[model samples]
Target: MTTPIQIGLLVFPNMTQLDLTGPLQVFAAVPQFVPDPGAEIHLIWKDLTPVSTDAVMVITPTVTFADCPQLDVICIPGGYGTDALIEDQEVLDFVRRQAEGARYVTSVCTGALVLGAAGLLKGYRAATHWTAMDMLGAFGAIPTHERVVVDRNRVTGGGVTAGIDFALTLVGEMFDHPTAESVQLRLEYDPHPPFNAGSPATAPADVLARYEELIAPNKVRRREAVARAATNLAG
Candidate 1:
């Protein structure tokens, strides 16, 4: 039998741990359904060292981007480092090259920011952390406000929680609805976030404003970084 689909899951410092591991659980649990010994899911990193999240979250790297085998899929996740990692050449390069090689490229939350930085968002209709979608156009992506946006082979999520939806969608794509449904059932994937504050529109006006104020600094930095990436691509 052919080797099972290989997935390259990119992780970085200050990433919302949930963004990476949540979708990870979706994919990792696939083996129980497919039971194909060849299926492999790798937690990739910039280096072999342990990486820390914004909330002091940390996870060891299993493979560096360089050693990342040509993958069937690549998953980029997001968190506090969204802005900073945008300007990181190492992170940008890894995302760019790996995405170029992968059959499909996906992101969760502001993880779309990384794909934007890698110049992969151009012409794609994608979703991201609502507050950050404005920056997507700076990189030429036509941003959409949805939990999951799929344009060609590029799949993006709205925020941290959307990772589960993103992965379930992919499972349906890679295999079939039965495969996805099976995995979803195993995950008890029924979701219900108690607060409506998850989306900009669903939340109260003042709460949205507060969120803007909190992320404003990162916005300035992310905007500049995206502009630079766009400029570099133009040249």
Candidate 2:
């Protein structure tokens, strides 16, 4: 019998729920679209305790880091919590160990910062939330400002909602266009926003300005976190 592909997603505190769930939904459907040896998804964390998200949602991890099998794909999703993760040695070490065996080391949004902290993104082209794009340079990564970026084995997504697009892209790469299409169609992943304000480039200047202002404090904290993480990586 063909062994099922192992996929692990890090479900940490304060993560954006969609960052993990969007990809989780996509990968969970792999068996329906593919042959017998399909993917098995695992929600991984330090323990089995329920993890709180940035929002009201709480997620329980199916596997702990020590118990997680070798993964074909290992993903980290991002949120306000990422700032703390960058300097978190235990979390960084766990990710580093997983990436060594994983065929794909991936992230969504500012989770790229966590990967960067693990010294995995050095010299790779990556994508992250626009606010943290410049910070990629600290980790020796080339920041690509697309919705999704694939550089060798490291795949990353831009922002919160880009997780869906990132997962679809991974499905395409892992299987084929038809498989990805099948998954997309199954999920009814059509997006139609009432306004074109999803991105800073497209948003009204005043809206973008207001967002920047709102996130100014976060930006400061993120920069400090990145600096500490970079220093840790350097040493």
Residue-level lDDT of model 1, residues 70-95, one tens digit each, is 88899889987777777788888888
> Deviation in angstroms for 137 in model 2?
0.7
C-alpha TM-scores of all predictions:
0.93, 0.98
Q: Write the per-residue lDDT of candidate 2 for residues 154-204, one digit (tens) a residue.
A: 999999899999999998998899999999999999999999999989999
What clash pairs does model 2 have?
A: none
What are the runs in model 1 whose C-alpha is more than 4 Å off? none
lDDT of 2 at 51: 98
| Sliding window of 10 residues with minimal summed lDDT for model 2 | 33-42
**Candidate 1: global Cα-lDDT?**
0.85
